[model samples]
Target: MRSFVVSVVSISLVASAVFAHSGVKNEDVMKRMKQMSEMASNMKVLGAMMKQQQPFDLPLAKAAISKIGELSAETGKSFATKAEDPKSEAKPIIWDEFDEFTKLADALTKDALQLQSSLKGPEDLRNVMATLGGACKQCHSKYRE
Candidate 1:
């Protein structure tokens, strides 16, 4: 679990650094990007705690999971508009297969809520993180370019 979190953070950091300063023009799309960034930041904290890189903070993990749940609940609405920004990685298939996208978003919301409710310790996060990552990949593979 520690290794997984490290890998995700390392990969995401490298990816973001490589593509820093996007040319996205739309405010709406930018908002979504910011939300995703925040989510990743939250995950990084949890990962750190889980890996013992930081002190175990149950409240922080709970809060992060809660925030994820809250944000995920609105994901469908957040992407409701067909706003286009060249900097956006979202693919056209998202609009074309809107139902499929929303379905995955809804599933994420549910999983986040479940994680928040059931989270007891780092071990729990370690187990649930895999599930969360899978949900993200499912949406990303189909909707994200």
Candidate 2:
């Protein structure tokens, strides 16, 4: 009876260690990625509204831009905290090329801040949209699958 209990505890310890080393949960990473995707979708809609030169919905546009900034910050945190999680779509190159990733993230934050600041009118918003799009493209091309 004593030997059986010891064997069970030893197996449990090894299993826990293996699981811990493998990767993050797929669902958890997907949830984080989905939040980012939703933020991007909202930004796209705001851009289209600005391009159309419709009555600038200041509140809505501001909210969307704010969400983008929030999500970008969250993404930066996740990338830093869960650096080893293979389940995240974030490329391993993100860690391997840390300087480049940090530069792009900084650019993204800057573009988002600019978008928030320049939402004074439709034309200004459109111009900021272009910069925001460039930031997204830059990061996606380098760090995403």
Candidate 3:
């Protein structure tokens, strides 16, 4: 009886391991999620700087915008390759409307690039920030929880 119980427990453990490997690990998805969260935080800081009409720190704004663009690109690539990752916060609607998600990601990339290019002055930066915010809202409303 003890041997049979041990065999059953070992089989359960192996089955769970197989199930766990079948889906994305939470750690991997959380890493990417944290990156996206950080990018959003940086964008918020840029927005606050713009609001204060600070001297338009070109280098800082450039770095922040570039990072945001990079994050957007990474998200797009991830969705393309591993859209079905079990740990993804992305809704099922995202996969159902995959083309739309791609389009939004492309739009985000364009908006970020535009913001990076037009970071000439405070007003231009504000305009770009507004555009970026709109793009972000549009995507989040549809895809993110």
Could you tell me the C-alpha RMSD of candidate 3 in Å? 15.0
Q: Residue by residue across 1-145, what tens digits does model 1's lDDT show?
A: 8668767877887588446537778988887887777667677777777788876778878898878777877888889998888788989888888888889989988998888888887788786667777887888888888
Q: Could you give me the TM-score of model 1 versus the true structure? A: 0.83
lDDT agreement with native, every candidate: 0.79, 0.68, 0.71
Report the candidate with higher lDDT, 1 versus 3.
1
RMSD to the true structure for each prediction, in A, is 5.2, 15.7, 15.0
lDDT of 2 by residue, 15-93 (tens): 6545543555565565566666666666655765776633467777877787777677666665664443465567778
| TM-score, structure 2 vs. true | 0.68
Compared with the true structure, model 3 gives a TM-score of 0.71
In model 1, the number of clashes is 0
Candidate 3: which stretches are off by over 4 Å?
A: 1-25, 53-55, 81-88
**Best candidate according to TM-score:** 1
